[model samples]
Target: MEGQAKGLLKLINEKGIHRNTKFLAIASGKGGVGKTNFAVNLAYILANDFDKKVLLIDADMGMANVHILVNVNTKKTLKDILNGERIEDIIFTTRNFDVLPGFSGIDAINEIDDSAVYKLVQNLNDISENYDFVLIDTSAGIDNKVISFIRASSKTYVLTTPEPTAIMDAYALIKSMKKLYDYSNFKIVVNMVKNEDEGIETFERLRSSIKKFLDIDVQLAGVIPLTKNLQKTVKKKQIISEVYPSDKFVLHLKKIAASEVGEPAPEIKEGFWDRVVSFLRKEG
Candidate 1:
């Protein structure tokens, strides 16, 4: 499988048919805010609805569950790649898109050294150019691992709810990250909102805080409504966009996807590989 994937990638490059892939990281400051579900559904919408190839990386290293949410069982994960397995062999392809499952319950993988982490990022960057988008579902919090992924991506989306605690934490994340890199490209997405008015209010509050304190402008991506059917879809271990195509929740997601479908990815000041290596070295 690894060889075949490589061969296909080579053919595409030879034909001059590949485009620059966009790397987007979806993260939050606290868990249970439905960040992973949003990442999975967004990937599905980009692939199935817009006919764009997408790769979803479960970057929640220790407690990854994107595979479970999508109801796909995998024998290997990012740990295997670190243990010398070909990245192509470990990638699980579904009808919608490809997934690079993350490590779960493996202490060594969870505590991977800077060198190993850099290698993993490099491998992902190598194959990323083959796809239209690479979306990473990062672990919640402002840890080194989480910040590293955000800094390396073309755009980092901070997810939060209307709750005050979640909102504060989200702001703290942006503030912390701003200290290390530019915050001009940060995007905000308010989730589990009761209505458009609620979502807009939440976004405004966060944006005002950032501008006043951090002095940076964050773009509003889109708002996801709180729908009862979303819980049912998750319980059934299915993607909302696919199972409930016409659901209001899915419709809003499609709107977000349409907004970004053909836009060129922002050019990183330093290349992806260089940025990853520089971040690791600084942390080391």
Candidate 2:
């Protein structure tokens, strides 16, 4: 099945692998934020609609389930790559994209070391050279594994919902990441929204919280509304965008993807210190 999927991707494009690749890391502060769902559908849309060569790296490592979500069986995973295995042995194809499956089973994830992380990043960088985009589906929660994937990527997205806990955790994750690297390339996506106004409200609240406490600015890439078909698609192991192309939810997601891949991120303005000083001076 995996090989057949690869053949499909190859048939979609006769030119073989692409040389320019963009890495987009999908991350969240906690589990159950639908990060994987977003990653899966986004990759599918890029592959099907945009006809781009995409590689979905299930960087969630220990708890990787991108394959399960899509109901595809992978023969090899990153476990072999970390154990002195050649990278070529682990790459597989999906229905619409290529996937570098994460490690599975028996302490494979727990045994990962700095050397493994380095090699993983290096291998990913090399693979990116041959694809149009590499969508990294990072593990939920603020673990070292998640951080490694997010920090290594060229772009990172923080996903949140209208739920209070989810929003707070998302903010926390953003704050923690900012401590390690510049958050300029970070963007937000509010998922499972009830309506457009609810989505905007959620974004505004989260943005305000970050601006107030962390004094960091974030861009809202877009929002995904909660639709019944989302669950149906997941149950069927299909992408909402593909199964229901005409669905409003899918259309909005396509728009988000278009903006995401169509342009480079705008330059982030001013350092946190500058923002703090400005606020203090204004108050005085």
Candidate 3:
């Protein structure tokens, strides 16, 4: 353990090492929207498709399951570090991913103390130099801790489903952050869609509401089609990208990763989400 910690520390402290590290925070307007799945797959694709070093951080304080989703049993998490355990000690490695899993049984770290939250993110940002990208998977809700994580990140992805409640929640999350931190660097990912058209329409409706009322722009990053493979992989505790690289979900994810790392330029459309959705669906 001590040796591993030392190695991890060295990886972080070495200057000009892994110079491409970009911190991205993935959040959902509501739960069960597949934000964690997107985070895990995007990190893997960035590493495999783009061949960039990637590190996944489970920033969801009270409820973390990235390890469970990826089928790794962990003995430590980010909470252990915040509680005085060494940050390097909590680091864990999987077959294709390295992760800093969040605390266990921590349903409400927001109630813990503001200083602890500050210190946690500070330590995280400090040792982030080792990887090319640091993907933070946060919990649902726009609480203080989640907002802080979103604020500290260089970029953010706000995830949602096609449900009305989910869209409202997504809007609430974005609006709340704008009010709190004037956060504007955000993108939207419509998950679990039946097709690209559904994804685009869902993205458009939410995009229009936020723009009309909040006066903020949320980019539609892309949409993930609802796939049984994604659901099955999670049930079996494996990554779909590892099990089924040819799946359409993986393909879209690769496209998303390419855009993130500059391999492919993302298509940008301007208009209310409803119009974008209608146009894409009709074309489909």
Candidate 4:
């Protein structure tokens, strides 16, 4: 076992795969928190505003909406890739970034086998290094699928709203994940807030609960205000930073993207791919 571990590490170092791509999984404990919207806009900002190569993978296996919001029509998705299509073949490119769209309303897609998950990661491994950041928009809640993706990411952003239910569910997610995965790198993003104060209060509430029980310190990544324009942009299928560049929400998103929450991309450890493979193996 020791020899095999060393061999795996050696191969990982030699390949140096995914060394330039910083994988960030944008996730939420419950649905309807605008997590997918955040993922899409963040990808656009990173690519257009910061001039970085971004690959936004719509990993919401059950109800994927990234492609819909981005107004990109795709006949093939990550589902096709899972069914033997090359990952490169399924990607749909836009002016902002490349999108690996996921299947929507497909039960089988949601129930992907462990081997298929391994293959999916393996295929992504081939091209992931080409980007500066790979943001995975994950399905809501703390299920096995969600946990698997979050575990593989360099950083996991736990998004939530100010509602008490949302806060509790987000806390529950972190609590559940803490037992099985590393919660140290988890960051909080409070969305749909009236102002920064509300966002901070929500984060503090969730952070206090987590620190009190899990004894894990979670960072406040950013706070997105409740803006009607964001909804309009979603309806129009337009990138917020493009159409409403001067909007407050857009400004906040730009700030978040320019800050450590995004820029000065994190260093990818030499054994990063090895860790991803190990996580998949354990899941399998």
Top model by lDDT, which number?
Answer: 1
lDDT for each residue of candidate 4 in 1-284, tens digit (9 for 90 to 100): 99999999888866764356788998888899989888888898888888888899887877888999989888898778678999888998886699999876434533677688678767777778777788999988976454666777778888999999989889888888888775556889889999889999899999898999999989988999888888888888987778888888878878778884445666655534456556555654
Best candidate according to TM-score = 1
lDDT by residue for model 2 (1-284), tens? 99999988887565543344566889988778788888888888888888888888887857888888888888778777777777777887776688888764523434556566567556655666567777888876765545655665667888999999989899888888787555546799999998999999999999998888888888899998888998898888877776789887788779888887788533323322233223323323
For each candidate in turn, the TM-score is 0.88, 0.79, 0.80, 0.85
Better of 2 and 3 by TM-score: 3
The TM-score, computed over Cα atoms with residue i paired to residue i, of candidate 4 is 0.85
How high is the CA lDDT of each candidate model? Answer: 0.84, 0.75, 0.76, 0.81
Q: Which regions of candidate 1 are displaced past 4 Å? A: 1-18, 104-122
lDDT at residue 120 of model 2 (Cα atoms): 56
Backbone clash tally (model 3) = 3
Q: Which stretches of candidate 3 lie over 4 Å from their true place?
A: 1-14, 17-20, 82-84, 104-123, 263-284
Deviation in Å, model 2, residue 11 alpha carbon: 22
Residue 165, candidate 1: C-alpha displacement in angstroms = 0.8
* lDDT of prediction 4: 0.81
Clashes by residue pair, model 2: none
